[model samples]
Target: MSLPFNVQRAQDRMGIEDPMADDPGLFHLSRTERLMAFGACFVIGLALSIIGSALVFTGHLAVFAVCYSLGNVVSLLGMCFLVGFKKHLKMAMAPVRLTAFIVYIAFLALTFVSAFAFDIAALCIVFAICQYCALAWYSASYIPYGRKIIKSTCGTFAKSI
Candidate 1:
C-alpha cells in the first residue's frame, strides 16, 4: 500500500529509506501493521493516563504518578513504529529539539522522584504540570512555525493584559 502524500513527505524528510525495513531476527511488519501498533499503544497510554487521573481523588498519589508517567513513556515509545527507535532518539536530540527534550525528560523523572522518593504530593503535581508543558513545547517544535505562532499569541495576550 502506498503512503499518504504527507506521510511520504515526512518519511522523505526524515531520511527513512523503507517503511518495511525490519530488524534482523525480529518482527517484520508493513506500514499498515506499524500504524495499527502505534494506534494501539496510543489508546493504551491514553487509557492509563485517564485511569491515573481518576485515581488521584482516591488518595493513591503514588499509583497516580506511576500510571501517568508510564502512560507518557508508552505513548512516546509508540513513535518508534513510525521511525526506528534510534532515528526517533536522534531526531529528539537534534539541536532544534534538544532543549525542549531535556526539559521534558527532566520533568518526567522529577515527577516520579517527587512522588516516590520525596513523597511530596504537591511537588509531584507541580512536576507533572511542568512535564506536560515541556511535552507540549517539544511537540510544537515538530510543526512548521508552531512555536513562533504560540510565542506570538502569548505575546499578544500578554500585551492585552
Candidate 2:
C-alpha cells in the first residue's frame, strides 16, 4: 500500500518534532481587546503611509491609503455604536479617538494627492483643514468619556452603553 504522503511529509529532513504538538490552544482577543487591536491598527496605517509617500512618488500607498481608509470607516462605525450611540462616556472611547488620529495622519497622503489634482476647491482645502482641527480638538474631549467607559467596562459603574 502507498504510504500516506501527508504523514510521510511530517518527517522533515531535520527530524525536528512538531514543536506546536503540545500547545493547549491559541490566543483569542476579547471584545474590548479586539477594539484596541483595531484601533492600534491605525498606527500601523500611518507608518505605512509615511513609507509609501517616500517610494514611487508615493509607494506603499496600497496599504496606507486604501487599508487605512478601510480602517477609518470601521473605526467610525465602532465609535458610533460603542461610544457615540451608547453615549456611556468611558475611557474606552479614547481608543476610537486614537483611531481617528491615526486616520488623520494617514489622510496627509490623500491631501497631497488632492492638492496636486485640485480635487477640492480652495474651500475644500479650507474645510479639510478645519475638519482635522476640530478632530484634534475633540480627541482630548473624549478623555473624560474614555475614563468613564473604562470604569464601566471594568464594572466600576454603568458608564458606557
Candidate 3:
C-alpha cells in the first residue's frame, strides 16, 4: 500500500512552497529557518549525549553507548563538512542530510530504549522524533542555497579548513 502522505502535501500543509520549485537545486530560506534547523540538530545531539552519559554512569548498556558514540561521531563529522560547504554543496545536500537524519534517529531510538527508564525513554523518543523531522526538513531546504558557492569552490574551501 502506498503511504498516505507525500512531500508535496506535507509542504502544502506546512505552508511552505516546493523548496525546489525554481531550480531543483536551489532552495532559498530565511535566516530564522536556518537557525531553527541548526538548533534542532543541536538539541538532538545534546539529548543523545545525555542519554549516553546516563548509560555510562550506571555501568550498564556499554554496547549501546558505544554504538551511539560511533554514530554520533560519523554524523557530526558529516555535518561539519556539510556546513563548511554549505555555500556550495547544492543538490547533493538533500540526500546527504536525509541519510544522516535517518541513521542518527535509528541509533537514537535504540540507545534510548536500552539506556533509560521506560517513561523517560518514551518522552525522549517522542521529542527526538519531532525535532529530527523539523531538522531534516529545514536542512533539506537550506542545502540548495549553497549550490553556487560549492560549484565555484570545488571543495577547495573545505580542504583549507
Q: Pick the candidate with the highest TM-score.
A: 1
Which ranges of candidate 3 are over 4 A from the true structure? Answer: 1-27, 62-161
Q: What is the descending lDDT order? A: 1, 3, 2
1-161: candidate 3 lDDT, tens digit per residue: 11237866887788864422332122343334444544665666666656755665455555435434543544443443323334334433466565545555565565456445443444454544544444454344455655445445757876788
Q: Report the C-alpha lDDT of model 2 over 33-114, residue by residue, as the tens digit.
A: 4346546655554554345334324433333334434433344334433233334233334665555554565554554465
- The 10 consecutive residues of candidate 1 with the worst lDDT sum are 19-28
lDDT of each candidate versus the true structure: 0.81, 0.44, 0.48
- Residue-level lDDT of model 1, residues 19-134, one tens digit each, is 34543112456777778888988898888888987887787889989888788778877777766676778789999999999999999999989988998888988998888788
lDDT of candidate model 1 versus the reference: 0.81
How much does each candidate deviate from the true structure in C-alpha RMSD? 3.9, 16.8, 14.6
TM-score of 1: 0.79
Q: Tell me model 2's lDDT, rounded to 2 decimals.
A: 0.44
Clashing pairs in 1: none
Ranking 2 against 3 by TM-score, winner: 2
